[model samples]
Target: MELVSKRAFLQMVSPLIQFKRFRGKINIQRPRLPHFEKAKYLAFTKPWFINPKKDKSQVELCKGFGEKLFEKDKENPFQEIIAQELRRWLTTSRLVVFYHHNPMNAEDEFKAYVMFKKQKMHFKKYGKRTLEMAVGGTPYETILDLYVSHNMTVFSPEPEIKKMLNITKKFPQLVLLAGILEGKLVSKNDLVKYSMIPSLQMAQAGLVQTINSVGSQLVSNLNSHQNTLVSHLSERAKQLEEDK
Candidate 1:
């Protein structure tokens, strides 16, 4: 038997076997295991096997140390813009009605928006923080407490209280809360009373009628004695002429 060179043997077998060259760097570092400061009690049992009281205690244990976990690093640019717009609306609009906005479907909300738009009123919503930023240190600041529970705002150039109330009746989702009207904070009941009040034109007409009635009565009373005296003199002249 003849002993063959290893290189010669490999060269002969290399044609039958193919080798692949790796293109990426090979990582040889060992992965380090994470250190656990305290061991947590992970439940391995089924839901039915878990004790309700113990589960609740475990949940409480997992809670943070009564501190807020997430804090806003900075205000969003859009949020600032919204706050500015809110201030402008509160300042410019003659009527600002705040409502506790109950959830409504898209169709109903669309209808409500259309109804408000037709009346030339604007419906707006903003975050609580945005509202506080906008309303603080302004005349409307008194109403800050009303900015709770999905609150929404409605703005109008005119104090069309009756019209707005009627529109709200059509959409119950917008529960009337409180509003600022003509620079006065008015409650829901006060708004109702205000809606019942007569319009400016009607009130003006009624006032004019009252003044005219008073003037007519005064003229009639002043002319009454003068007319009586004139009638007596005319009768006296007729008697003298008859005698002549």
Candidate 2:
């Protein structure tokens, strides 16, 4: 074999080396966290059971500390923190909990997260205004309805909770767990039932239709009586004319 100089060999392989380095960097990039647009309800995964504390550093780290720390703390620190956060958020807005076994892959999760962020921004900007424009409710009622609907729109899956009761695999790994409504913790079954119930708008529309139906029937009955009287008078007029 012909002898090759180190400089010549390195120069020949420079492009290949650069390509490998570029690939390494791409591989090392941290996966993006899931973003929830209008995430009226806060959700987390099984990881919450491991470290409930938002600030992981706060857990006192000591030499030889392991499972003992968890054993000593009867309650899960992570779960407590999550619960507290739920309470705070629920006070101002609506909240629900969801659990999933298989999380989305990094790429898909990141895309979903991006979409969520965009939706959240959009809701924040126009949600209130849209609620105000809604018909058949007082200002206070509309405002309250707006908050409820806003939270519903954010958390519930399509084709909306009103339309469908079952939690489908629409979002794949994400499963509906529990919900907090009107400052109460609702079980999964309750949540489902609640979702099945007609929304304020829907219920109102139904009521309006019922009232209109009753009014129409009343008007029809009155018209029938008038028609009968007209027929009777016409017969009487014909009989009198014939006698004359």
Candidate 3:
């Protein structure tokens, strides 16, 4: 039964469907101990000092130590860290170090990494759209949308890059060229040229590609089953097939 469930879990994380994790590293201050007490709150937990394999008895309500540390007073700690970490993540731009593995599944981790990585691109796209809305300017769906939609400007193509894009003659099926750098979105083809990557949606496509490249049959099955279950709930599949 457990194997079946784990198989299902893996399937849900399969790259074809593009599952992601939004994990955040947390390093808040631990509780201070009383002069009489032996040590800090960390000392209370057995795992930090003693048995590494077993889970330590969780700490209870004590303001930041509890409220800031764990979620719903449950055994899960990663989710709690995520909540706090996101609050300051964009602002700090700090690297989150992991002492141990996150408790969440691979899907959640994938989403988290994508979200963190593509955060800047999404933000810039949002900013452009927001500004465009004020002047009745066309807001692009993606950063590329701004250029492709308006033919805003022609990029200075590199000598090799121009030849590379010209390969559409040899590979007729080739559609687009994509490149990412420090959360920037860039695309160029035989016709149009480079610009920032635009939105979360675009990032989602890239995420999907990554997942499919690193294929996992189990994860695909899980995701497919979940999709089937969802589609059944809405009767969407039946209606779509009927329409066709």
**Highest lDDT, which number?**
1
| Candidate numbers, best lDDT first, in rank order | 1, 2, 3
TM-score on alpha carbons, each prediction: 0.62, 0.43, 0.14
Candidate 3 lDDT, 70-127, residue by residue in tens: 6544443554444343333323322111111214455654554444333321111112
TM-score of 3: 0.14
User: lDDT of candidate 3?
Assistant: 0.39
Off by over 4 Å in 3: 1-159, 180-183, 189-244
Query: In model 3, how large is the Cα lDDT of residue 128?
Result: 28
In angstroms, the error of model 3 at 155 is: 19
lDDT against true structure, model 1:
0.85
Go through the candidates in order and give the clash count of each: 0, 3, 19
Kindly give the stretch of ten consecutive residues in candidate 1 with the minimal lDDT sum.
37-46
Task: List lDDT for all candidates, in order.
Answer: 0.85, 0.48, 0.39
In Å, residue 134's CA in model 3 sits off its true spot by 37
In terms of lDDT, which candidate is stronger, 1 or 2?
1
The residue pairs that clash in candidate 2, if any, are 35-113, 37-116, 52-78
In the range 138-186, model 2's lDDT, one tens digit per residue, is 3223233324321322332221333222333445654445444554556
Candidate 2 weakest lDDT stretch, 10 residues: 120-129
